[model samples]
Target: MTDIDHELEVKAVAALSDGPFKCGTVAIVGRPNVGKSTLLNHILGMKLAITSRKAQTTRHRLLGIHTTDDTQYLFVDTPGFQQKHLNALNKGLNKTVTQVLTEVDVVLFVIEPMKLGDADRKVLQLLSDKTPTILVVNKLDLMGDKGNILPLIQDFDLEFPFSEIVPVSAKKSLNLDELLKSIRTYLPEQEAIYSEDELTDKNERFLAAELVREKIFRLLGDEIPYSVAVEVEKFEVVGKLRRIFCAIIVDKDSQKPMLIGKNGEKLKQISTEARQDMEKLFGGKVYLETWVKVKGGWADDARALKSLGY
Candidate 1:
């Protein structure tokens, strides 16, 4: 927030007849495993998006609203565009990516420094011509040469005329202030779209389910995480305490034991971590109950996928 930028923000608000607020939708788009959800979580200063090392952790479009004193940014975190391992689930996730691109006011195309691949190019192709995209070079802390960043930016600059280029490290919380400012500059002069205190469009139930799924992704191995889906069977708010009952859906019977672990230890650990996260997110006491259920071939079944909220 420079002095000049602050002054411009003030003038844009009072100078306009509507109000002195700026609000717009921002879409964070990138290929699978490119840290799109991580960047969104970092920008909002909270863990609204569920991120894991495994790709396709985010299956649905999530709107995380960050309201500053002067502007409100509705950040849409979409599932990564899948190019490999085509299936019904992947198809739905890929459809989510393209659908969100058409609805946002601006786009943040996050990518690694020099690891651009075919999937990255395919995501770039999905961007609409009318929208101004900021090419965010994420994971800057992983790079050894700071000087080579310019050439990397130029390489992408030739592919598409980006509005601006910002290099940031989402994991280390580096250079994100600049990224936020860059995103705000593209916002239109209008009143806030959502209430100032609202953080996301999703309810607490959705977040609890996603949190459970995140732990499953983080703790599990191999293809087990992909076969897992979380459903909140019950969400009860009693006074200041919240009691949530959740079910972890697995495609096969063999995968059930992996989530439950020996003596149900893995499920216990997952519940404890998820409850702690829910406590932090809700600012209240959370009592979470979790169990594993076998929903064979839910990923491939169309009706089962719909029931699982795919």
Candidate 2:
């Protein structure tokens, strides 16, 4: 071979070896109670997004960042697209999901194992074919038979031409590496968007409020959890300590007693648990103070919802 040919071959091999880095936004979307937040927290390896057993627990667009040696994943965990309850709060949440779908580089359409219904289909309608999407069949731990997954994957393939389909158990942290590898394939070659150590875009105050709200959703009965909203009235940071004051808003005066319990024991339990979580997440001691107040139909009121940061 000529010297010129060998030089050209060496350059080509060098170009292929130095592959461009990948960094882009990925949106995680699905119906309520489909373990979207759980998936995000697992990917992040921390509790950045709040979780609960109740539906509609996530009401905002949360950004969780996971950076590896070769790629950085900017995951936007969106609220579950609401179909039934068209209240002011839910409408806002649905808007968040649609807005995120358009802006993301890749879309992770999360759903439960073998249970795709009208609500899941509704979310699928929002996805654009232009954007690379992956069907993440979460909760594989709950599935009894592993053989059923193959047919389930085929069934989902008929609905949309997904770039790739990955079944993951977010709760058990199974097949996450495979899921990340599939996601990295579609990420555009670019520089990192966030710092390597940064975990999320949300501030500590927002996380504190979410922790308190999560406890409420987990501890309380179904009726009261939806009506409640938490606001950090004051967040004072002094060196290694953080002092937080939160207001727990209720829709009616009758509901206040239920949250407060017989002698404020219920609220105390909620505060203690929330504070403990805050310490672990924040890496500092947190003194959390909470109180209940009546908001009188804030969930339906547009003005109230706006004030509450919905």
Candidate 3:
């Protein structure tokens, strides 16, 4: 076996020990766009979540594993909490954050450094059971005055007695190592949750779909990306080549033209970029096909969301 593989075997053996050192789930919870997904990606040293300035980009609880010589952390990246309308998608999205409470050893409550609103207060009230919540103040890099964040911590410190308050810049990778060290301190003794080589619970099809959705989020503005869903209909891996067929589902028929653009130029660009990234991900040649379809208010339909594996 290779040196790295041998190390994994040793760690796997060490994990079988009776006492001390373990693996557990650390759920990242926060309001929309607080960099919860970004922070998880940073901790795992890979882009496992689709991140953007847009709200509700993460609709599911994604598990990213970080295994070390002594500990393994299964970081759960949850959907951002937001206002839910009558729409089923919104309701499902709202439930995603709330559902995370039941299945975690530690809850990393991410809040922006700028302000703590009523939503933050509500989260504090909901997590009143003292579930080992860590109040994480993210986006420190965006603040002009670093010292300004300290006061917010002091102010809210009385409102909610958090297990630990950590200030970090998820985008800039600031204080992430310290965060990991802190997380490891809380986990209980257990065997590794997954194989050491496994980085995420999401399959290749899911990642492939996410790549397209992320590209749309990056390129398209307004409500276009939010009302969008990418599904990989076909994925064939033949030796060094990968063939992928994906569909972009939109709520309105009018949105199709915007995604396709004039003479399919826009769609081509999106595919080219996504395919290049996919090739890098798989380390092989990729043949990608993209098609846009209108699902007629599919975003509001619970059945649609369920079918999409949400």
**TM-score of each model, in listed order:** 0.92, 0.93, 0.91
**Per-residue lDDT for 171 in model 3?**
89
Instruction: Please give the lDDT score at residue 53 for candidate 3.
Output: 77
Candidate 2 scores a C-alpha RMSD against the true structure in Å of 6.9
Per-residue lDDT for 138 in model 1? 89
lDDT of each: 0.86, 0.89, 0.82
List ranges where model 1 is wrong by over 4 Å.
Answer: 1-20, 223-225
- Among the numbered candidates, top TM-score falls to 2
Model with the higher TM-score, candidate 1 or 2: 2
Off by over 4 Å in 2: 1-18, 223-225
Predicted candidate 1 versus true structure: per-residue lDDT over 95-158, tens digit per residue: 8888888888999998988767887899999997699999988899998889988788878888
lDDT of 1: 0.86
lDDT of 2: 0.89
Clashing pairs in 3: none
Report the lDDT tens digits of candidate 3 across residue range 1-310: 5777656775766767545657899989877888899999888777778887777778777889888866789988988777644368877776777778877899899998867888777666656455788888888788888878778888877877788888899989999988887887788887665767789988888888888888887777674757889888899998888899999999888889989989999899889989988887777899999999889888777788888988
Report the number of backbone clashes for model 3: 0
Better of 1 and 3 by lDDT: 1
